[model samples]
Target: MSDGATTRVVIIGGGFAGINAAKVLARDRRIAVTLIDRSNHHLFQPLLYQVAMAGLSPADIAVPIRGLLSRFRKVSVVQDTVTGIDLEAKQVSATGQSWSYDYLVVATGARHAYFGHDEWESNAPGLKTLSQATEIRRRVLQAFESAENEEDPEVRKELLTFAIVGGGPTGVELAGAIAELSRSTLTKDFRRIDPRRTRVVLIEAGPQILAAFSAASAVRATRDLEELGAQVWTESLVTDVSEDSITIGNDGEKLRTRTVLWAAGVHASELGSALSGELDRQGRVPVGADLSVAGHPEVFALGDLARTEDDSGAVLPGVAPVAMQAGRYVGRLIRAELAGKERRPFRYVDKGQMATIGRSKAVVETGRLRLGGFLAWAAWLLIHIYYLSSFRNRALVLVQWAWSYVTFGRGARLIVDREWRNPET
Candidate 1:
């Protein structure tokens, strides 16, 4: 597949956008693609909360990048951390190497933002990566383990309380899963502390949870969460997050809890700043209608890192579908150029949005089709399962879900981390 005369395409960050871009570009024999990422695998980020809550293993939601690209003869996978970019030279500099490219695709994605309080990151862990999910899982399960041996009732109560910052999908899912995990999974497992009594608080500065969703859906989700025993606190700003607790509001209403999971906000990945371009407040680079960087048409920015508005002037939301579609468009554009075909502007098709609260509880929005409760939940499950990269993962996840549903027990509940060794001490 090596044509002596070929276009060198370098894609950074093997996330949804990068992967999709590479897949599409691989079809062109004249395009030699190199995909680089810090991580070796492509993660299904939507299901990362399940991993954090011990409902799914890391392997269940991730596929190796090398394996994914093995079929594509022209595409090479590189495992390296991209440090910076040399736009003038048209090359990407990683930790140990630098590669020149005829065209570049930046899909580095975003990371958890603590709203200028970077110090809070240590106190309240965010669920963005597999390691963070495992760490949260460790802290969550260890809290119960330490509470079982704790003598002081107040200390035990503090250990039992789980506070989550942000009321978005991640926060809501975590709150619901924590509540269900306490009431169902760990009910008979713990002898000293009744997991059912575990306090789960979801703190949101916004007026409603899932602010992107319909207000009706938000109300329904709030009710469902409350029914599961999670305290949903809206218009509550977290001022400070200390090791033992988090302080909320100007009134400094402190909630003492050992575990704090952050799902608050995210800023674009640092890679966006590598190029000399205008960045939005959220650090996203503004791309053209074709998803190309301004003044640098050969350079493309995809996924959460790129900011583009629709025809109605509403900016596209940072979701998987948007990224995938953008990647596909860029790929087609590049191919069209190579083939001397006319290129068209990229357009995002607004597919419906869905979020699951807990078992048999979810919300779905698709044009005029609004679904909730068991129907939405089932749809959520099937959609996620279908999107999984491999058939093996789909089968494994389905089996795990079935087992967890039947027995009300989480299969991946093992707390395997060094921090758990003497967490309370």
Candidate 2:
């Protein structure tokens, strides 16, 4: 609005998709871009668990948005929550202020869903944002320090046990990292309770863990998890969660763990549901082949929030590559529109999927190639570092990973907050 000649483009998220879009759009001098996010920095979500486990710092995985676009005079970043959009006026309302835009992009991402039992969220938390990761980090380290001094064996055991309520990549990675923290790093720290005796249980309602992967890969991951002394409870469902214990389905099994990480499922953030458009049961707006919302050419949604089916009628999975590709595609489409040309439909370029299990163990599927174990782990590590935004982040992550690999130690282990009681009650 400040410049009469500049066409204002408002992006309502700063995650993978939004950041990439801004970076791409900054190339043009006529476009005025404003990126709005709740936080100042863009986060690398893939390695968030590493931050939670103290292997990486917040600065390592997060880069300040303004720092990224310092030289791009046409770009501006705002840390604010977008509350509403005026479709007719082509304006956005956020942080109690309104801004008009010629084009709008929604990339607000997703959050963990509690299904119908919303009250269960307090007891079981998920890792998503930077603050959530930091809280989990504090809780994880505090659990160890608490278990070190507790007198009652049952209480100490409860404090030591950890339950992860999903078997996906985030769940698997967190479980493995915590397991290593207990089995290897703290094996010699405590005298009262053997830290290696800490129990980590992964629960899933599906028939198998890593359901996204092939049956062979999932089965192998299950075996590897068990080999690492983590209890992989397939076909297990969580019926109830309390501060002290998790009730496991109709089955009588219960894990008395003070800490539970929710990685089971995620629903699109509030922005998606706010749109008066047709949406799936998961709250994602079903998009056409061109990745545009039906009937809305001025509005585009990307990242985990948009459900876009490919030519085969299969919806693309919510992954980093999908969002990044969608962002780049949308940026180009906007460019086409500016040039008085018709926009082309979007097509996702699948760069493959990979998940690391434990030390030197991973599964990767790229093109026709399927790899596992050490080779896959190396590939996964390289790919994550390469996609990171900052060269400093890449260097820091590489150094931290190298140190972790060599010493079997995690660095960002400081607990900045005190634990609160009655986590569920």
Candidate 3:
């Protein structure tokens, strides 16, 4: 293998996949690693719901990308939005500059898909980034404040209603957390309005919530949400969403809610289309067995921007584990190639899936184990804490969780934005 910057590696996106890939590649002193991302921080997206629900601050989940990579002498970070890829030139063009690389790793990730209703985004914010989570938190907290001062009963009722579209893990978690926040956290804070009477709804167009999970797990989660005073509406399509209300199904049933959170679908990053290849329906580039684009051997795509089918021809779900495993796999694969070793096809390890629904409630699905309630919740907490980037973040999260459990107080409840007026009011 050539040494002293003989090979250049450029990794787009500082999410789980790119970060892991850079870490692995940095071990080879012969290769220089450059990780580029628009944001300076690497956010742990799985716990973003907690930020939106005021249970955790943004800093508790996001760590500076550069600081994490500072120890790696060969790894450098750049802050820029990727515009497109020049495959023939082996270069990536950003906003103001371009960088050539011997190997390119695309892990730009995905954004929320509103299906065909792109206009609904302003009214129904999705939980994806730190900014989006903070916006949703602002809306949620402001809704309560607005309800407290409003004299009209109808307006108060509208302000107290929270509607979440999509019944996936994010939607379920958000609904349950909002329910708990209303029934528990904000109960004593409001004087004129009773937060306990707030309405929380989860809408899903599918036949059941958490369709990816087993039927029993879905049933258990639905029951858990119901116990928390959240209404789970299945087979309910959100036809229209506005600042003040949302229309569900073809019958045009209007739900007057000031807060609407979207967690329905996600589309791959625009960089997927910029690459020279056929893209999946969701704009993800289909990779070969080695996780490289068909035409470009040096170009590899990982995480949500990549679409790969298993032996059974089922597309792998775009989860954090998949991204992380793919990242490490690609990193090792590149190292092997540099060492003149035979490269192997990428394979994913099925680690299991777990989703938390408020306190002491969760659903976990393993190979032969189906756990729910406290056990699953504990497993979820431990797993997330273990996967967090640093010990400090894990410690902060654990302490915050314990304090919230005992006192029912969310320390990150402060709404810093004062000028964001509620359009519904």
Tens digits of per-residue lDDT for model 2 on 285-384?
7776666666677888898999988888898888898998888888888877888998777877887888888666888888888888789999999898
Candidate 3 RMSD computed on C-alpha atoms after optimal superposition onto the true structure: 2.7
Better of 2 and 3 by TM-score: 3
Tell how far residue 233 is off in model 1, in angstroms. 0.5
User: Per-residue CA lDDT of candidate 1, range 44-108, in tens?
Assistant: 89999999999999999888999988999989999989998988879899988999998999999
How does residue 392 of candidate 3 score in lDDT?
59
Per-model clash counts, in order, read: 0, 0, 0
Evaluated against the true structure, the overall lDDT of model 1 is 0.90
Candidate 3 ranges beyond 4 A from true positions: 1-5, 418-425
Compared with the true structure, the alpha-carbon lDDT of candidate 3 equals: 0.90
TM-score of each: 0.97, 0.96, 0.97
lDDT of 3 by residue, 172-281 (tens): 99999999999998888977899999999999999999989999999999999999999999999999999899999888999999889999999999889877458988
Question: What's the lDDT for residue 135 in model 2?
Answer: 84
| Reference-based lDDT, residue 295, model 3 | 85
Give residue 336's lDDT in candidate 3 (0 to 100).
Answer: 91
Clashes of 3: 0
What TM-score, to 2 decimals, does candidate 2 have? 0.96
